[model samples]
Target: MNFLPTDDQLAFRDTAVRFAREKLAGTYLQRARIHTLDRQLVREMGALGLIGPDLPEEFGGMGLDYTTAGLMTEAIAYGDFNISYIQLLASLMGGMVAQHAGRDISMEWIPRVIAGEKIIGLGLTEPRGGSDAAGLQLKAEKTANGWRLNGEKTSMSAADQADAAVIFARTEDSTTGSNGVSAFFVDLTEKGISRTHFDDIGTKPVGRGSVFFDDVVIPSECLMATEGRAFGTIMAGFDFSRALIGLECIAPAQASVDETWAYIQEREAFGAPLAQYQGVTFPLAEAETQLTMMRQLCYYTLNLRDSGNSHTAEAAMCKWYVPKTTCEIIHQCLILHGHYGYTTDLPFHQRYNDVLGLQIGDGTAQIQKLVIAREKVGRVALQYDKQAKGGAA
Candidate 1:
């Protein structure tokens, strides 16, 4: 019901914003040219308790709630888009490991992650299976010793920067349906693995790349949950990660709006403040309207998570709604800036590139719509509590 950030959250957000502007906004060019996320910044993020903020303190995390964590996402994003992107992705990936793995796994890895000592990224999308996670072509075959992974994941974020990755690969009888997926913890620096980063529109530091593991060894202990059940782990992960992606969308959208607002109040066009023009005002208003709607949906999905309720269809809806809306809002904000926005002189263009990635990351808008349609026309939305009671992750 409350649509506002708490006072402390707001203060934290302001601090993050100031830190971002002072630290990153002016320096990084939108070449999509950078190769790795700033480890120092990441260290600062860990020190601030932003990375895996919701995780337990004993694990070296602050264990903030989803609501507070979501607010922090918006705050970090307000300063620079790439930081927000990296921050949220790290949190979600770490959350998956912390949530599913045993105490031994948590004790060994969680503290390091919370200390900004390590980075975790997800690698599930393959060249052949962009939207179809269950159809992942990567193979992780069970062995007498442990398991062997062999395949390439494409267009993933943070491949090079991550100390480890949460990978979803085919393990069960491929003849079967979505039952074949199994998630694993693959060390990036392991033998028979090659990592490469691509030049992208934004979030250059996160290092979107391909991970090819050729007969790479994985210990049995590194397996998350059990075999043939990863489709549910992945599906539930989407429900959580997708909603978080919505917050990612919201952050850049807010940044674009804030920057545009600042420019309009000060910049004179035709001897009048730019905000005076209907052309400028109307688009801003329209963008705000869309962002408001998207933010509502984002919060709703987060609430579902907090309540331990199933809202898979809602996750799809927000995933589709927020990123697309965010992309649109960023461009509109840029258009208002005219020549200034188009240049790296202002952060508008950087935001434009940053927001571009969100539209496709996590899941494309097309995939989300299909999920929503499938839910409406066939089965009910995914149920977290009920499904868990039935032993469904």
Candidate 2:
């Protein structure tokens, strides 16, 4: 894989940095205090073409490769930790709609999503358990007019703020686990729908919450692709999102590291700069080393995707490792700031809180490890219970 970025990728990264500086730098944390982003900020992101990097150009996207999308996400996270999620949702859910939804729906909504005119949330994780994604309980019953959806999707990003969402519901009762589930593009304003936002510790601008669907009606056209076949496609998109999330968390830690570097060079201890002490300098060096490794792994996963290769294991590795490592690095950076980093005056605390949330979202470290193990060992672990029972004397 190429270590150096292409001209187009560099240009996209530059644009992302400029956009973050102008639109997010000072205002993001202030807005997060209120627990939501301004609608106008999202529109501005759309105007700058930062919303959907990997989507086709015909659908108002840059049509760049997924690696370039990762670059944009990484760059933006430097300024605003929560706002990067807009691009994250755009890349994952927006791509799913573009590929699986009907032609008319895709033509109408994908451009709006790409342009940031509308926000869409992915509704997969329920209140029961997020890791066992295939074990969803939301039920969609067939009706005369169309389908009636009755369920609650909890911990959805942009839950209350999103104009619409791609919701998954159980459509069949066959022995198949995930195949019994199907995907739907539902308008959030429809009757019988109620929402409430969460008071999350971090990433508040994205508005995680629960969406209740009580006999919500969905037209047949809204069903994405075929019944009993949507989970595989949606999970594949998660493989892509997992890698992007790695950069999303790492970029902020990286920014903290940069800030700490500058601070140590200027601040003095024992009549010398803090940078002169090995205790101060070595930790930063180690943080930088970890950041560099995670960044390379993120790009490698994205490159695998760009080359049309199966990267589920690599993506899982990224999802599990990056956030955990970034959490440690940022913690070190916080301590390096001595007392100032613990306060709200600086962005360090906010970034730490934000990155901490990622360790639980998308797929948790345990879930990602499970996916990686399954890919490497072919589900033997999954059948360990059966094997253990058989081996019992």
Candidate 3:
């Protein structure tokens, strides 16, 4: 049965699908090889109001809803996951600033990001600490002028091109955990702020890099969410963004499936079509069924998310299930393609590499399990729930 898409959602999906197929079409391998963010495509997406569909209209966005955001993100991911990552993050970061920080920052930065004139990265991961993001070692100190950020953030996506960034750093009075962390908005072009790109297996178009903050003095306008309150913003991002990660897992798996399905129908063996072989049919059946489950779970999580409830457990379930399933499906599709899947010519090789990041980013599967386990058995949050919502702090 068809799982989602109200009439309006269907229309939204149609618009996104057309954009994906037409504008975002390119060889995934080529995109990665160049490691260049498609500035033109990003601007076109902004012009189409795809960047911040849920952000406030006054802030230069459509301000739709979670469902619409998910629909659009998934559609674009179906074409290019790198594009999905940029648009999803730019819009979400802007909205977060609106919600937790203020309207002024959103009003100014949101439009620039939406227009693809700027990029932003969440600087949580550090050289010393990763999953223990609260245990971050990067230090930020107060100054007469503003703040001085002195530390390094690793595995930062889009850092090289980012006009601005949210750099999480350790504070002097910080307690043992996330409390000790504060967020700073650092301009990449500002003095003492430097970044170097890192080559990786997938998502090469991501401008992923190491950003060193060498006493980078950020002005007051650059401050994103407040210092002590910054950790809250980062944690809050995951609950929603994890659901988006589920969509990320699906895109390449879906692409591989479609590609393999066509190939199987066209290629023949044993004097008959490979489609007639149970060997071919069973794997396809398994991949489709597994992907169906991932899709359903993601849809449910998105619905729960829209209801103002904590879907962290469900998001965890999806973040765990979808990537594993997507990886398996992609591998199976690759096998079904024989050697073509292994070739850079087909793009499956690149897709196979790209799917690995979803499992690692947005809190690893192991970390996600810890989150759910803490929430479920103890009826508690990993961090203290200040709002009494029984959710993440």
On TM-score, the leading prediction is 2
Q: Give the runs in model 1 whose Cα sits over 4 Å from its true position.
A: 11-15, 28-32, 380-393
lDDT-superior candidate, 1 or 3: 3
lDDT (tens digit, per residue) of candidate 3 on 287-351:
88887878788877878877787787888888877887798888888888888767877777777
For candidate 3, the per-residue lDDT at 283 reads 89
Candidate 2 residues lying further than 4 Å off, grouped into runs, are 387-393
Model 1, span 279-336: residue lDDT tens: 8888888888888888788777777777788788989987888877787888888888
Sliding window of 10 residues with minimal summed lDDT for model 1: 377-386
Candidate 1 TM-score, true structure as reference: 0.90
Residue 272's lDDT within candidate 1 is 98
After best superposition, candidate 3 residue 245: deviation in angstroms? 1.1
Counted clashes in each candidate structure: 1, 0, 1
- Of the pair 2 and 3, which is ahead by lDDT? 2
Candidate 3 has which clashing residue pairs, if any?
Answer: 174-180
TM-score of each: 0.90, 0.97, 0.92
For each candidate, the alpha-carbon lDDT, in order, equals: 0.76, 0.88, 0.77
Q: Judged by lDDT against the true structure, how good is candidate 3?
A: 0.77
